[model samples]
Target chain A: MSGVRLLVGTRKGAFVLTSDGKRQDWMVEGPLFGGWEVFHVKASPADPKRIFASLSKGWFGQVIQRSDDGGKNWEPIGNEFAYGAGPGNHLWYDGSERPFEFTRIWQFHPSREDPDVVLAGAEDAAIFRSEDGGRNWDELTSLRASTGSGWQPGAGGLCLHTILSNPADPAQLRIAISAAGVFGSEDSGKNWKPMNRGLSSEYIPDPDAEIGHCVHRIANHPERPEVLFMQKHWDVMRSDDGGANWREISGNLPSDFGFAIGVHAHEPETVYVVPITSDSEHFPPEGRLRVYRSRTGGNEWEPLTSGLPQENCYVNVLRGAMSLDDLDPCGVYFGTTAGQVYASADDGDSWTEIVRDLPAVLSVEVQTLS
Target chain B: MIRVRLPEQLRTLAGVGKEVGVEVAGEITLRGVIDAIEASYPMLRGTIRDPATGRRRPFIRFFVAEQDYSNLGPDDPLPTALSGGREVLMVVGAIAGG
Candidate 1:
């Protein structure tokens, strides 16, 4: 295994953190994309040298970029995968009817089975697939016109933030939306079905209803593709049979409403989530910052507050801020709204503030580069 | 009339450190307020809106009370309740990925 590198994307720019295994020394290089909002960052699982980023320019539009040499160079793949309205098509923005511009690419994943296949979940609930290592793309029909008008943009652009591909079966994929619950695709995104069995959504008329809930992040164990975990807007859930069915796993967590979820690379039953105030308030619960760890398949959770701020911690971590490394001893890290990055070398047992006084962090990823 | 609250970065460009008050009468649109604000602060002309189309830039987001105003036209009249006293039109810099 090579040294683990952490990539931190923020409101202003992006930071690359290279650690020496020992937590004391770190090399940080960044401010990439120059203030563009980077929603997601990931290194190719098949080739760590390849990197991808999803950037949103607020009112302008969203873009995807690729770097083959570990962030040494970059290229944009926006126009290649963009959905456009043809001559007779009426679904477009403005009078040009230029098919809705991708507002953001909230999640990026490369297929474990096919190194050339890339998956992206974007704002407006769109899922894209690229077969040539992100050089080209095609809109996946699983999230396309078949879902009907009910798939209209949610309050935040009907965003799809998380995409999980089964390590065992490349044909199976799962996606999470902010206000649209969860959907699973069995035929590589050609067709889709709802998988919100035990989820909850207060935004809908029925508070306990499973279908219309808000999902912030979704993660899966690399070894056990049948098990999936997610951090919902108001709850945490697990699906034992991939995403065919789900059960609430937030009984022991501090607050159900959280932004991100991280599953241990090799441990199928271990995962991590950061609890924050739900809809009414967006701060840390009771004015304290804590990361909860679940070892028993989310049946129970324990708060890991060691090396964290004890009081007056008002910063909120967004959905993409937290991430885990695949190193033997996984490195867990998260950035805060107040422009800070914290890292834990021993899973979620203890922590250290790696950097301070940067821009609000939007997402973080760990890449092992020799 | 509708009042617009400038973000910190735009405020600095407008030569003010804090919020700037702009009055939008008639059909209060995002474009109308932006044009008025730019006219008052010439240095901010191309910062908020594009020079040719006058479309809102990618970094700036408009909000009427707590609602997002990005999808609405600049000439669209805001709800009367949102235009009432002390109801501010906020221009915020949206935060993207981590």
Candidate 2:
């Protein structure tokens, strides 16, 4: 029987929700690492049974947990993450130079063909690759050689949050860092170059600089990897030639400052974004939680509000808090800062709460099993 | 044999009880007890202290009896009571909450 598993990473622990493709009834099992914070939990596409989770705490530093039999059991792997090229200096919030330090893993991207090969993005902004099933990791230091001195932290610290791997070209890769803009690697993460050409940020001294854009999220469909959608600090951007050039696509939406963005599996041009009120206030506009969809790839957008909260709701959707499954009709899932995980089994027309009262979800990932 | 008390989180990570017993060879010192603990539980190698600098983490503290041994050097000899296992060495997390 076909099934789906949703791995939820929260402020307190990790939860695993499973259902048989009907997407209605779900079995929730959770609080795995009881008191620790789970930043992300993701399954390997090549081997669905292999899963990786980024677990950490303010008192305990960081811990990486790996599950061989799906999410049934997990074993703690290596937790050591040291910057490769001796700690370099970057602009601090006060405009003073501060040395880069490794704090925690923010995101994990496993190789599509090899389960043992995975990539980890870390805070203080660096990338590490693990070839031996995450037992060890080596930093790809060459990426910093491109432009490391000028990178600064956004409000959330300098974190390498979003990593996108191309399905057609194995060597092509893209990663986004807050306050540093987007960077692309054509040689499988060995070398990188800033890809923030047409992006403009008013907060920085230079509005159209090469870097420092503070991109919250970036997503692209596997079928058409060249086209990308992004939720920037204040603008919804769309790139045509894979980040070489970007243009604003925040048309008709109530607000453009959001953190989560995703593309539909069946329809590549169909995209989704939750419009937060503004940069200072992270809640929805007018206390109404809505998911705006665009069918024309960029400009024209429509609010999908059949089953969403219409009034007296103020919740924030984080960057890694939303995901989509590749099943027929395509299920859309998102968790909120207010501890609610909602799902729309039929594209974004309506929704149902999968499970509530989870500790402030940090990330939600979906695995579609055939 | 020396008795050591770990913080709640470290105890949970190491899968131990209220306290653990360790065999310390040579003079009893802050460094000796930690080496023995890491040798016994490999998973706790980098939790209490950093492996790169060989220094205690800013948030982790070591206490012997009622006095704080956190500021003492790693090689400094600890209280003699610890040598006979009469007193317990406590590994504590600083009073910092998230």
Q: Judged by DockQ, which candidate is best?
A: 2
| Candidate 1 lDDT over residue span A13-129, tens digit each | 678888776655787888777656887778888887788887655543445667889888876553344553222122222223333444567778887656677888776567888
Question: For candidate 1 chain A, which ten residues in a row score worst on lDDT?
Answer: A86-95
Clashing pairs in 2: none
* Model 2, runs deviating above 4 Å: none
For model 2 the local lDDT of residue A287 reads 94
A32: Cα error in model 2, Å:
0.7
lDDT tens per residue, model 2, B5-78? 99998887788997999999888888899999989987677777766567788888888889999988999899
> Candidate 2 residues A240-322, lDDT tens each?
89999999999999999999999999999999999999989999999999998898997899888877888988889999999
Tell me the whole-model lDDT of each prediction, alpha carbons only. 0.74, 0.89
Evaluated against the true structure, the overall lDDT of model 2 is 0.89
Highest-scoring model, TM-score = 2
